[model samples]
Target: MKRDERSIRVLLIEDNPGDALLVEEYLEEYILRPDLKHVERFQKAKPLITDGNENYDIILLDLTLPDISKEQLIENIKHLAVEYPVVILTGYSDLEFAVKSLSMGVSDYLVKDTISSLVLYKSVLYSIERHRFIRSLRESEKRYMDLFQLSPAPMWVYDPETNAILDVNEAAINHYGYSKEEFLGMTQSALCVKDSNEDAAEKIEALGSASDRTIQSHRKKNGTIINVEIINNYIYFKACKRVIVLATDVTEKLAHLEAIELQNKQLREIAWMQSHVVRAPVSRLMGIIDLMKTGELDMAEKEQMLDFIFSSAEELDEIIRDISAKSEEAFSDLNKEK
Candidate 1:
């Protein structure tokens, strides 16, 4: 819906009847006819504003309410500013206090003697718009905070320059075995297990330019080293440059991959033994049997051929045993890995 065409609900708290009438007339002059509700005392206005049943777009408040002291009124206005935009109406005598109240969370202030319809309309409209923008910004920040805290993967924010941990989530605290207070007290490099590739400065530089991921060794509170894939992104958090990190533990995954590769190497060796070692003895037996079947030898020569056959058979039996033993060993290793 269009902003100007929308209805505005305004609550005016003023004791003087003439001043309240002037405000109602000024709001009526605008094309947008605000549903203006007038109350003479601060006590009466409090329940109307705070009851939740009546939602107000903006509040036009007289700085001199009969039931509320100046100091108490200012305090009340500050609390109301969180829920509604408030514009102060005052005489020239209270002009200084009105001006000061603007800093204390009053959206705007206007002197009643010189107030015009145009000025009042602008103040009310502008205050409501500005308050809406501020509320939206706060809500967006809250949603981001929720996502960061509730994520399953370990997440943390750190200062890029000093490498100091700024904030960490519950997952990060649990995974790293550190309390939130301990994590904040330590630098980012404290969690790192220094090794050949401990180039944290260079990695932080890369992270500042763009989102990146790197594999590194990290140590837990218990001194156990773990492999982690860290994904980093640059962010401006709470008006300061920071880097957010998400860590995934890849220790078990990498170990499983290495085991599979070793199993493949063993299987290849077994296949080679079958093709080369097993083939030699089987071929020798075949040649010796063919010679015996020919029956073309004398008694002594036949006995010699028989000896050759017996020797080839023994060799083939030993080769078969070796192949069986190696096949069993390779399978046993694979099963243990699984």
Candidate 2:
């Protein structure tokens, strides 16, 4: 089979054998030979539709069939849970009927007498193409929706002039503690703290000017404030210019930084005490011992001083070791925290 001529399994429901043969001949004569299946009545088509063994790409239905009304036949085929494009083939030339068929979910309508091989091929191709396009659009939309809903950070789009939220994702709704509908109804000003010095108008204008990310604080629903890093850019949606703001809550992160700074200050004080105040007495004792060893005293004084020197030296050694251990431990703790 050619690429475009891959057998398009077609279910043709027409009581007229001549009409069925004509359709088959058209299929074979055309450059695209669609694999055709003939069902003389709606009753016969029902099994093909329900069996699950046969897969038809398109259903060509004749409205004036003996077994069932066009509407009933279409509905019964749909009830079989088979999803394929159906084109209505009718002898009736009533414009109202054609419109009704379209409204009833028929993909296209063709007048039986005017049908040609080119028309048949084109109609099938156009219907299949259209169906594929619609399916693609729906799948793309679903994927976008899933990602938006499952995002870890808050995201929103708003009208800058009114400061009104136009749209918010699921994360935004959860983070702000508001329903999706409620969030959309809220204005940006409402999310700003009452005592905030940040001007809402100025911020909005700045947001419009921003090419990518900006940081700001937002008020939560419970009247608490949160620091948010906002990424904003201009977007044209439905012919309306709007700003899309993607906000990440960083209040906890800021608090963590502050806590780390406090810890660092305390650690510095401990290190200073061990290095200077605690080491000063030990240094003085060492100096006294050095003077005795340099023969700066008489024998009797030296003997008495030797005992003092040894005692002082032992005391200094213990203090020095203790200070060293404490300093090492403090540094290790600091490293762990970092």
Candidate 3:
């Protein structure tokens, strides 16, 4: 037989020899070749459960055992750290006891006289499947919880309609200078500068309209404002649709970019001025000097013209030097600030 075709292992805890035989016979007749291990008392089952030598998928536990009462027997078996599903086999049809056993984590309760062989097989299958599902759900929830709390960025869940803060992570508490309890009491409006309330509201409205992330400014508890890029989406939390906001502080990054843009603009302006404005006057003086050297006029006129050309050249050179000095000083100040 294939691995899946192999018989299911069952641990039968029954003190009555006749009932044990009946259970064995029922499994043989109705269940498809189940492997059954019979234990006459709860004490005998203890070692098997603790040692983990036997791998049983289900346990058919007699509620009233000679060695231990129904409650005590279930509690002791639980301490053995076995995770197999347990179905209580009760001789009496006690609804209260059945409910109590279920509350104590018993997978299912079966009254021996009432439940047919088919019903018993179905109950066992259903109980095992249900227990597996419950365990899987708990493990998934734990993983999500770990990621939610341990993330580096500030994250929160808030009710969009009521504008109530529902949840916050550790990064938010640290960044905003507020405790998790304090942040819960405050709305998004409370985290905005008084003057920026309208801006904040408009941004929030835009977020609600689109399913994409957005950038906005937020104010901290200490009155310090920060530029944050928030990635928000709608989710159903606690039976209601809410907004999940994952915000990262981008204040310093934006500031650096803006500063770089301003510096580039200033450098372009200086380059334009140097290439056009300062060069034009210097070129004119050089042309005048070349004319003076050719000796194209009288001595007196030539001397006067030469003096005029030299003075003009001196003035042009002074102007160019002044421009260069000013440009260098401005760039130097920028570098110092950097």
TM-score of each: 0.82, 0.65, 0.74
How far out, in Å, is residue 126 in model 1? 1.3
| Local accuracy of candidate 1 as per-residue lDDT tens digits, 59-126 | 99999988999999998989999899999999999999999998988899999998998899889989
lDDT of 3 by residue, 203-273 (tens): 44453634344557788888888877777778886689998888877667666555555667767777877
RMSD of 3: 5.3
Model 1's TM-score against the true structure: 0.82
How much is 257 displaced in model 2, in angstroms?
Answer: 1.8
What is the per-residue lDDT of model 2 for residues 1-338, given as tens digits with 9 covering 90 to 100? 44355768888988999999998887676646578889898888878887879988888887778888756765764543226677877776554676676755567888888999879888887777776676687789789767766778888888879989988888888898888888888987777554232343244435364434445778777877887767777888678999877787756655555556666776786678778866776676677778866875888887887677677678667766876776676566656755
Residue 116, candidate 3: Cα error in Å is: 2.9
- Number of the predicted model whose TM-score against the real structure is largest: 1
Tell me which residue pairs clash in candidate 3.
none
Q: Number of the top candidate by lDDT? A: 1
